[model samples]
Target: MAWGLAEFDAERRGKKEGYSAGLSDGISQGIQQGISQGAQQKAIETAKNMLTFGDSIEKISQVTGLSEEEIKSLIK
Candidate 1:
């Protein structure tokens, strides 16, 4: 009976560890995806603002770290 209880405890601990790992991975992925999306949005907005300021697409790309083609596509 004692041995059976010990084996059950070990299995429970393993499951807990697996759950914690999966949760951590999910949270990390969500945070990174949010950050990447935010950066892309900011870049696009910056390009649009530069357009309003009469800057060329190339200049916007330089300032925002976006490609010229991306800036042009945003403008359209």
Candidate 2:
């Protein structure tokens, strides 16, 4: 019947829209996480270089935004 076809079509459209929205949100979150991880990695590398140059843990922490504990761990 016409009414049954219309209902089926509406349901299908709703599912497609939901899937698209979810995919978009997932992509955005993935990008944000990747950026955060990259920044953290860069900070760690900078801290290591500073350590090699005899920088104090507190100084490295201040400059790199990493904790003193993290800088100390890098010595190992």
Candidate 3:
């Protein structure tokens, strides 16, 4: 029947819309995670450089926003 067809079409459309929204959200989250990881890596690299220059662990932690333990790990 025409009504049954209409219902089916609506259901399919809803599923498509839901999938699109989920995919968009997933991409956005992935991008944010990548950016965060990249920033963290940069901070670590900077901390290592500071260490090479004989900077104190506390100073590196303050400047790079990393923990003193993390800076100490880089020393090894």
Which candidate wins on lDDT? Answer: 2
Q: How far does residue 34 in candidate 2 sit from its true spot (Å)? A: 0.1
- Give the runs in model 1 whose Cα sits over 4 Å from its true position: 1-3
Question: Which residue pairs clash in candidate 3?
Answer: none
Q: TM-score of model 2 relative to the true fold?
A: 0.93
Report how far residue 36 has shifted in candidate 1, in Å: 1.2
Give all candidates' CA lDDT scores. 0.90, 0.96, 0.94
Candidate 3 Cα errors over 4 Å, as ranges: 1-3
Q: Write down the TM-score of every candidate.
A: 0.88, 0.93, 0.94
C-alpha displacement of 47 in model 1, angstroms? 0.4
Worst 10 residues of 2 by lDDT: 1-10
Tens-place lDDT digits, model 1, residues 1-76: 4568889999999999999999999999999999999999999998898899999877888889999888878767
RMSD to true structure for each model, in Å: 2.3, 1.9, 1.9
lDDT for position 15 in model 1: 100
Clashes of each: 0, 0, 0
lDDT of 3 by residue, 1-76 (tens): 4568889999999999999999999999999999999999999999989988999999999999999998888888
